[model samples]
Target: MAIRPRTAALFAVILVVTLGVVGVIVHNATRSSTSSSGTVTWWLPDWDWDVATTLVRRFESENPSLHVEMVKTTGGTVANKVSVALDAGNTPDLITESIARTKTYIDKGQLADLTSLYDNAMPASDFAPGLTDVLSVDGKTYAVPYRWATNALIYNTDLFAKAGISGPPTTWPEFINDAKKLTTSTVAGTAWPMQGDPSDLTLRFLDFALQGGTTIKNGTPRFTRDSVEQALELIGTSVVEGYASKSSFELDNTGIRDLFLQGRIAMYLGGVFDADRAVGQKFPVGTAIAPGPSGPGVQEGVGWAYIVPKAAKNLDGAKKLASFLGRPENMASLTLTFPARVSAARDAKFRTDVRKAYGEQLSEHSIPAPNDPRWTAMIPFVHDTIQEVALGSKNPQQGAAAIMTEADKNLGPAQ
Candidate 1:
């Protein structure tokens, strides 16, 4: 999560500001150069520079006929920039971005078909089941899900010991109870991120709602009133009951993590990386399966992927590179977290005590975040309502209704 984590804001800008508007065309597009036949242009996220460079070098050496020109793009800005380039029909041969972003392009027929290459390079059965679904629309693949992660319950063990708590919470009731027990003047029991990136806020809310039967399908939001209210109540009442810090109103995932490390809060529902963050730090950490109302909750698995544009200057070369990157070993190496391929994840790096909960949650209880074209537009409704509800300006009942109302306005009434 952070792969370093984000994009909701970026896509919102793309949908609202860049779509169908080819305003100022910069001479240099964040696009692959169409200068020559053997030059395969790739847009890489800055975080992946080193490892991706090594892989690119290897690719060039192995192929001998093709040279890769990697145009590195920073996170949070890449999506919007790429969207503008796409609107202008200026594209790189390959793009590295969140897999969910592919649906928007595929819907517009802007991506090349990768089904043959994907099957030949990495078979569907080798990946975690359903991982490739995000890259395909109507069973024709368009991208490769290269990286993935799921959330888990990350707790400060020292705090648990000091509070006389025996272990991590195993159920939702126990989770709230633990938060209550951990609360003190010095430390709030837990916290939820209520502000900052609206998309992150939406995902955090869904982290709980997913267990309550909330889902989005084909760009339409879906859930019963009880489930949405229950999800909001857990987040909102935690603050009202004094078991959660009010700082949550201002915190995002990074802010909440900082507070956890500083011991201002005892625990949080966080990404798999959060499970290992306390290593070499003052306090020890523990991870457990994030709990649901009854037991372990279903968490959302999210990550980056490789895509080839239909207008790619080197479509054949782009598909070749995508297939190469999608290989199990390469996928594992490229990902900072878990790879989409199940076989790739059998690598020792993914097998650790701290990451156990991630494995369980992902293999058993996780689902891909829905690929909704309207997700960018719908985030504000979720964000604003959750903030109002948590601050007591509105009750959970009203907050749930607002979300549905917004969803209907943006996505056409849940299909």
Candidate 2:
């Protein structure tokens, strides 16, 4: 499996920090009333330092009034660092973060409202459709998304044509039928990772829950819902019925991709980068939206966004930097994956055949994963139960029930 050993250790520390700190985030937090100097303290992740620093320089050159003091921060630990900083009233003016880590800040009212700043950057319609979802709460926006990506129905065009199938499936029935048609003695249709990092399994299952239109109750989607049962059966039965690959229980994302690249599988739901890897290979790759019970289904994916904290001393400088960075050209330069703006995605670098489906899905059919602190604690419970259901150790009904019972414990008294 491609699961990192260090991730478990990191999560152990984060779970402690997140659970203990989210409750009283604003209790000791002090807000900034008087504006400070023109220097903007921007905490940027180390992963993309080269591009980020260049952009910071560009922003400074364009706007001579504001100077950006770039601070190199680790993306994985920035959330914890920021939380401690907010507690000590030493907040930075700007930071780039994953939506999952940004949720706690947004929930505790520690983030500044970016709705007006976002609109000034670009119209709502101009941005990708479902990508804006996590950045907003109750009709208000708190972050500006620049980089985004999504899962798509990635298929081998040669296998589809050989099977006499015209295109990728758009409904549940068609999806199952296609899986059956694509499967052969030599090739399995698709595979899902059952035993790797729990977060990966949880996100994959959540994609199906979103696609099935599962009703989220009490601000959290319930495992006892009918849609959840359907999702489990749909995935579990496919492997059991021999339509999907039987090796799924042991395969992680990288393992599945290895099989696909070797022509052992026909199609699967995967990230845009999966198709990107298939380019110029032995066979052509085609990508489409994940099918719903009825029509196009929504898949959950993650993205990085720029957020301004409530206690930002240089608010004006942060706002100027955000607006400048949100421009289409700047967005294209910053993103390693698909940019959040449709216009930014129209850049020649992003218009390749493999990139088209991802852009469309991000624009029309994707949503951000539910960003709650408890979700991390709930991951293993959901992952282990889903694996049992898929392997026939328990039926869908029993699996769903088991997941909820274990999860509700970690979820605490609920919001």
Candidate 3:
């Protein structure tokens, strides 16, 4: 097993038993304001409302005086919604978005100072370190992490055994060879969305760069020429050698996952979200931490965060809600997501079994995405460049240079 030594020994063998009855929605009119006083409107990015709704019911149940009305907003431009609302002089009480978009919101004064709230509501050290770093600027914390994820090497156990392989590859070279062996005339070696999908490319490339010991600093991508070339070369090999398809460029997020489910690929690079789906589909899937040049490597902390706007009227109530949810016992019962709180994740029972896998993956190699607001904005364009490079429409070296140029052009000086 390629499981990290620190991780393997940390989790104890404990069986998690669920009750027959799970609470659905306990909706009560617990508005943050009285019927005569008006409501505290909140704008949350569209996600699994099941979790949010559960939390909402709990919040309302605890605080009878305050009622919360929520409006689900589209992702990628949550900051824009906040700005427009501010311009209209009717901002939501609480807003949620990715850490990437949080930068723009913080800069434009659309966010409320969460320093005191973080201190009083949640312990500073409790949350994921990488997430804390991203949400903090100039020593002030701005958000609470709600969800997180990272890439895993999900393989077809049946396929690996049939190919005379015992386990998932632990190094880049081994991965390549195994992928080649897994490649069938009809099925691909592996599949992950590599099209003009910004979200897919940004995360996948970030993981690759981290494996190669590269980092982005001051909004500039940093990697030795060889490392950069090697990273792109790997992508090239996947496509040109037929381990992965050139048609990958045409697949969207859903399309790629669909292909993997249909058994068209032996392996896929994705997160626990996909893992959960595979389990539901009864795919007999085996998972491993994503491997790099080294054994059991991964990059970029993938997860969610919670943020309270400065403009929120019920700041105290909001902070209370955030604190309550972050509690380890409460978090475990409510969601399958790994706890952002270190102490919460430290429990042996929670740290082992099915959840242990997710926990260890986060603790080992959870690097933060580039924090520059402009770089965050340019994620889409970078994905486009990757698609071009992989498809041979653009040379890898030239593509790398073009990425730097485009990034610098869009990401103005941090002054």
* Residues 18-128 of candidate 3: C-alpha lDDT, one tens digit per residue: 221221121223331246243456677676456767877877787776676878887667667766775565666666556656666666665666677566446776666
Summarize candidate 2's per-residue lDDT along 74-188 as a digit string, tens digits. 9568878888986677888998877776778888888888888756448766777655666778888888888887788889888899999999999889999998988999899
Error of 2 at 279 (Å): 0.7
Best by TM-score: 1
The lDDT values for all models are 0.82, 0.79, 0.67
Worst 10 residues of 3 by lDDT: 15-24
Candidates ranked, most accurate by lDDT first: 1, 2, 3
Q: Worst ten-residue run, lDDT, model 1?
A: 23-32
The runs of at least 3 residues in candidate 2 whose Cα sits more than 4 Å from the true structure, single-residue gaps closed, are: 1-36, 74-76, 130-133, 216-219, 222-224, 280-283, 404-415
Q: Which candidate is the best by lDDT?
A: 1
lDDT, candidate 1, 1-415, per-residue tens: 4532247777777877664454333323323233467889999899999999999998999888799999989988998977887878899999998866778888988888888975545888776657777677788988878888878899989899998999999899999999999999989899987767787777878777877877756534576677778888998888877898999988988899889999888998888666667764745889888888888788777888888888888898898898889888888888888998888888888988888788887888888887777866777878888878888999999999988777677666653
Q: Against the correct fold, how does model 2 do in TM-score?
A: 0.81
TM-score of each: 0.89, 0.81, 0.81
Candidate 2 local lDDT, residue 325: 87
